[model samples]
Target: MSKEMQEKTIGFDSFPVEIIHDILRYLRKADMSTLYSCIRVNRNLCKLVIPYIWNNPMPNTYSLINLEIFINLFDEKDKNLLKNQYELDIDDTYQPLFNYTSYIKVLDPRGVRRAAFYWLKNYYVQKFPYSDIYVDFKNNPIIDIIEKSLLRIILKNSSKIENLILDFAEKYQDIPSCNIFLLKELQQGGEGGESNQSEQLSHGIREITKLSIMNPSLKRFDNIQEFLDLLPTICTNIKKIKFYDLFFIEPTMELKLCNVIKSQRNLTSINLTYNIFGLISVIRHQRNSLKKLVLRYIHHNDICLFNTFDQLINLEFLEINECFPINIILEPLIRANLKLVTLKIIDIEGIEGKYDLVESIIKSSGSTLKHLSLNIYVDLIEDKLPLSKLCPNLIHLDLKVSIRVIDEDDDIDVESKKQPTIFNYIDSLKHLKNLHLEFAFYVIGYFEEFDQYINFINFPSLRFISLKDQHYSSNFFKRWFEHFSTMFNKITFYIDSESDEYYFDPLDDFVQEMNDNGLSLVYTFDGYSNFVATDRILC
Candidate 1:
């Protein structure tokens, strides 16, 4: 070879297939698949690529080959484990695995069930340690073919299959019509097994720690207490049960969720986001055993309806959105039993400038809380509240305050920047990084850098910042952009538009006229209630 050719092609041609495959594994899956098709044209190329075909290990390790894949190709007892099984989706990154899978499958790509399993059996199963099995299979034509082949393969390998996760949505590939029909039996209560609470109780899923029933076909339940009772009995070992997008419009809906919480006496976490359950009805029950609770879309009602419940004694994390009854929420928690460490309250009203509940939580917890978040409607307040005393142990803080509105006729020189609007006290929170808000323009004037009032508080840990109609200097945002670490979750901005009927966004279109370069914008929306608005964080 010429000297230049020798130098350029040193290891490209002769490097072991494992090394070559590893180098190319991260290329776009489409590119890699094309390379695979070409590589198989030669014996040496086929041998190297085949051995490492199903190995992927960033999110989580996967043999990709298990009985789940080969059941259609082989018998239940035919597919033996070449080695142990392990899962590869450790990180919760929701990105497509197979690049350009739709084009190859001739249908929408859900999960990589078929190719991964086929590769596993044909090559790597006997060599590596595969203990965890992840089957979040999305349905596709090629994937369906592979899944049908893996059933027999899985049955033979299941005894060795220690952990298997079925992260599939409501519909899955290679599943029988009868199985889909079973889950949707309640939706269609005819010609099949009626969902008798006595017989179909939640017992079989005892070992499942995390179970998410997204787009569940089971809608209305005639048996309320019976279903809730089974929660504790049937899923005794379950730690989390996530119900996504299930709507309950019947009068008995409140009691259904309430009774369900009662049954989960041993559960440490519960998430009913996008479900039709209201917070008032769900929070009324005793959930002392719950350590984490997430409630979304409970509606923004400041009619003294939702009382701050102290019954959640063991609560460590609380995230509430599209909710209301601000004053009534915290008094009960302060007066009764409550232990919370993290709080995120967004898009509500009547929480103008109240720190009583937060203060109570801090004092009662003996400074155990590490995070605090608040997005309130406090345009009428004259006093800037004190959060330092309330959450003394706070490690992260986001406060958006609004001062009294300035009239159009008011003289520009008359409004002094030195004067503290309603939110002067909050600007001193220099120790925060993940800042969130739509600050009141005048409210933040007290901390204007022009005056010595706005001290340069360096939030070395500030990774994500949220803004909701709170006016802030873009210069300040660019500063935080440099300091935040890479591991920071989405640095989103949620902006809220205000109105008299409701302080929310009233824009037909967020028309942005870019003259030259793109700019950073944070927006949040809370339009559920006519009385209250939400903050949309746009980053």
Candidate 2:
């Protein structure tokens, strides 16, 4: 090696181990690719990077390969089970360089099931290339066996699992044994009834602080009920619980689920969807400790029940989505005098007293709120929303405007209507840093007015602005930037359209033009299922 390069390498090697470890940790958080490269540099770096890499392997595309590595870490008994019972093969002589499974801290069963499904599909496709057996691979019992085996390996080895997300949707029958496996793991007993009491007790199921359960259908309510009944006994320290798409819950099961919530000693956050029986009463039990509450698709008829929200004195974040009589829900919060740091009300439905309730809620929490998101009618925006007076401390604001359709036979003069722009109300919010605007449909003759509004406003702290669900011509943005390019550091356009015929030729030119001028502009095409990137600005 050259003298300069050798000296630099020696200097880096001489740094304290703690400093090196901290640098690697920062690299891992900032960029996974940089950390992966660091691990290849030397033995010391590899030792530090391996744990970060294996600590939470799911929620990534590479989890399928990570599961294979985990299977390789299995003991001889599991290896024999996979080969003899499940017709899966593993090299018995192979050993992992490190105890990789022991480093796992987050276990996502949904991701594991997905990886296992794909793994089995690939296996069957290769094993029976000419046969049609792989077509029905989803119904194959081996997939369940594989998933159970992998969970067993993780439960047996990992010292602690900090997060567990249980999503039993669509194919609940396929993995019926998962609850049993978890129960056994928590009880410190393995598949063969062998108890390793002291060692298994440290395996971290009891240490779970965050749990998410997405139970959409009632087909497997019995299975879910059994699992919910088991949680209060095993997991008492859970702080965050999320229930998604629980539309068909019965009264008895709801009580069991509520019991689980009431059992948590330190529960601070709860997210509920649809309507659960006696939900308000159950949440009242945790009012003193709960800090964040989210309610979605809440179409319950009992407006009197929401009065329990007044008891949540410690709540700092609140989100309500697609719920009605929104006025009744917000009334309790307004009376509660919550110092919310973040409040999001999306797709709220109500004809009477909607705006007043929202304004009141914001007025009550304005002193402490930093993030505010609202989806309201376009008519309300035209009437003017006094957000600056309601929430002065808001740093991030997201405004989504919905509009009623006007028929061609109508004689309403839309252009003559005095449509007040968002700029009219936000000029006083000096602390605002980010702004997001979403339009339900494109308003034809508003570009000129929007540009004029932008020219008059002054946002001192604003750095980023995002426009969603609207189609804007490239010339409009060109004209906009020509006048006020210095106003924002970055601007993104999220185009949502019904027809696929929309073209982006002019927008592409505008994006390239902005990049050449030392400015950042991004255009993203959003469809029902996926996002198509038209342009990206790399910093």
Candidate 3:
């Protein structure tokens, strides 16, 4: 190596071990590839990074190379077992330095199942002719054996597993004895009688408290009722249950879920999407320990479900997303008198009750509510609600006005309408901090009208304002943010749709102007997943 390179290397090595460990920890978590590259830097770097990389060694995604590395971790006996029993071809030439599974304190069997299926499909595609009738992976016995074998090996190796997430895939649905078999192996006493073995299995399963059944595809499974009932019996002390994309809500499944809820009194939080039956089931059980609840895609017919919300005494955080007939839900919700700290009712759509429902929810939780987000269906500027009655302790507010254009030939007189302007009541919210506002209609040539609406109000506690969810010219966004720069701590403009050519020049000019003026303003685009704040930004 060159003299300068040697000197640089020595400089990095001279740093204290604690500092090196801290730096390596970040790279290990944030950038695995970069962390792996550092293994060649020095002996000290290699020693510090190896543990973090191996802590969760199993690759969740499709990577043939990584799968080979995983296979090589097994010793000679386990390697032979895989070859003889499962018919998996082991690479004799490759050898691993250490047992990687020993470092794992967590196991996600669903991820391993997904990766194995992905690898098998790709492997078969390369060796066989492509056909329209796809392989039925659900009925594949070899895949089932491979999945269970991998899971059992990992569970056996990890002596102190603290977390386990189960995806109720096809195997768990079809194979009734899958849980019993897996748990029997996990227990130390395998040769006990049937009654003793059942006790041991329950004891074995209760060691983990955090569980997430993330079946995003929402595939309906047979014998789901039995599976749902088995969860509480196994993991009696489970604290949280997260259900995602559970679209197929059945009566028996709901009954089983309610039974599970009644059995597990330790459950504190539940997060579900598009599962009205599950939501109703939670309400029916009346669990006082439940503190947080999230519901998505709630329909109008589900209004009756909120009648039981009053029973939840410890409920603090509630979020309802994509709720239809948004206005009717508020009466029952308000009657429940839920002293919520964070309340977000997003994507609200209905014709008449939009104004009254929002007014009531705000008034009911005015004393305790801290974070509030609302997406009203009507034009917020044309049919404004009384924002002055908002929660006194509100810290964050997201409001979107859906209409920005007025038809010239319409018969209704603008002067006769009694609805308040958008800016009329914001000055009353004393504790409001973060603000997100969306103007989502065609308003390109109406900058004067937009500016006129912005002139009437100022929020004393406002920190930032995000203008998003619809299309607008980049220049118009820049001009608006510049006008209100002093009124906010920072201003963000999210342009959802724009001509690629028209946006480039104006976006560049806006960034340059913000730089020159020492202004805190950002311009971004809805890169993925609609207009969510978590989406990537272009600038």
Candidate 4:
């Protein structure tokens, strides 16, 4: 090392305890997380830092997590820490979560059913003030302990939860059970049956609000009459309905969904995702009460589906995912006089096609639209969709861009070619605030002189940006921090993991070196899921 560089010293004990804590608090949570892992450098430092470390949303990278568990295995210490000291921070955009769900596997089919039962029962059976139950017993193999147990629970305590979400995935032995279960639950008892059990589990025609049956196995549900009886009660209370992943909403499924919409006067929010449900007639008819609509991943192969959207009057948030198979004409969807706050789409490949389609939508109804999320998979996005045009008033945009390259050759031609950045048109964005961009981690045109084509981004009021699927190295991350120091108060870097503690202090000397300079760190992402990358600017 040169004498000049060696002379740059990282001060130790240069500041008092209060100033040190202030500096540490000002640093990004990611930096804090990185710091906590290396706390063993000094025992006194460990005592001062470990408590606050849990408060930061850094990735739990404890190799000895089972050890962290061993340390606070009881309700006494851990619960106190969680309430008084540890702040539980949860970000939904981090893709998947890292907790226990990842570790546990289904060793047996019965185990899955048992797990589903307790989860669903606890989640749904609490609405004792309402009515109805939709236990998804379709194709459930064997009348095992799980089936008998769930059937008994619903049969005994049947009058609550107006809207029920059922897992209709096919298995076997579910036919006779579904038949017996519905008949027994929906059957009202005779006179003198108004006893203690009847008073609590009141069978005075339970009203159902909506039902979303998502399991695909439909061959076993044989109790049409009993299921239809529940439909009448659902019709009285249910406003909107959906049948996900089932191509031809069975004759019974269609009857039940349709009956509920026609019978329930206040129904709203009808979502039939994956387009397997061929009951657009029911969907269109319920347009008056329906406000939130979502249809995605359905290979409908029908142009009429797009043509029939004008019938929905109360539509608000619309999300159509992976609709490449279906030819979606965006014109009618925009002109339909419905208040749209959010419009999300997928498989819109060509950049020009997307820009043009969106331009037309903005020309028609873009002013009224507030939020838009689009995921496009293409090599290079052209003109970057001039977001200032269509979404001029847009607030939340979950924009995802995936560019596939063969390899890093870097031998491609230049000079005669004129390719600019995807953010060139951002100058006119006066109304945008929270902008999320998912692309490569590096800022393409950053760190250049005045001769450079693109200068800088100034989202004066912008607060949050979530970059999915982009992981950065330690050095690049530090440099990136210096570049965007002016943009945000909180910046989060998300990775794909959630296990392990992502919170650990980087070397004290390294942090002190940066502090001695003018760098400010804010946040860090280092879990099997999304945790906080905590850092902030110093100067």
Best by TM-score: 2
lDDT of 2 by residue, 1-539 (tens): 89999887774568788898888778767888888887787887688789888777764353345456666655566667778987775555556788877888888766666667777666666777877764243465666666666777777778788888776566544344535446464464344344555557667477889888766555645666676687788889999988887667667767877888999998999998887646656898898899999998887667778878889988999999888767778878888988889989886442323777777777888779899888766555555556777787889988776555558996655555535455676667888777776655564245345545556666566666655545455555565666545544444434334324344555556667777554444434464111111222333
Q: Which tens-of-lDDT digit does each residue in 1-539 have in candidate 3?
A: 99999887776668898988898779877898998898888777777777777666555665542455565544455667667875666575666665555566556665666656766666566656575435455666555655665665565555455566665654434433445324654455456577866555433345666666655224555444446667667656767666666566566666665565567657777777674565555654645787777777767465666667656657688777776655445656666667778877776352334656566656767678888777653334354445656576777887765542358986544443413355664546777667776655533132234534554555566655555534445555555655665454344444444337566566656656776444433334553111112211222
Q: Best to worst by TM-score, what's the order?
A: 2, 3, 4, 1
> Which lDDT value does model 2 have at 422?
57
TM per candidate: 0.49, 0.80, 0.71, 0.56
Worst 10 residues of 4 by lDDT: 58-67
Backbone clash count for every predicted candidate, in the order shown:
64, 0, 0, 56
User: What lDDT would candidate 3 get against the real structure?
Assistant: 0.59
lDDT of 3 at 302: 59
Candidate 3 lowest-lDDT run of ten? 528-537
C-alpha root-mean-square deviation, each candidate: 14.8, 5.3, 6.8, 16.6
* Per-residue lDDT of candidate 1, residues 1-539 (tens digit): 89999888775467775666666665435465665584556666654554234332112234342333223334222233221133321222334322221112111112335455445444433444484533334533333444433322222222121112332233432233222212233234424354553233231233346545333223432232243344444443556656556553344544544554555446677766553535344554446567877766554445344454656677888776655444455666666555677876654543545555554565676456677766543433234344544454566766555443448895543244433432354444444444554555444433454222323333344444443433433344333333331333333323343323232222212213221222223443562111111222335
- Whichever of 3 and 4 has more TM-score, that candidate is 3
Question: Model 2, stretches more than 4 Å misplaced?
Answer: 1-38, 58-63, 66-78, 84-88, 124-141, 174-196, 220-224, 348-352, 378-385, 402-421, 443-448, 468-475, 488-515, 519-539
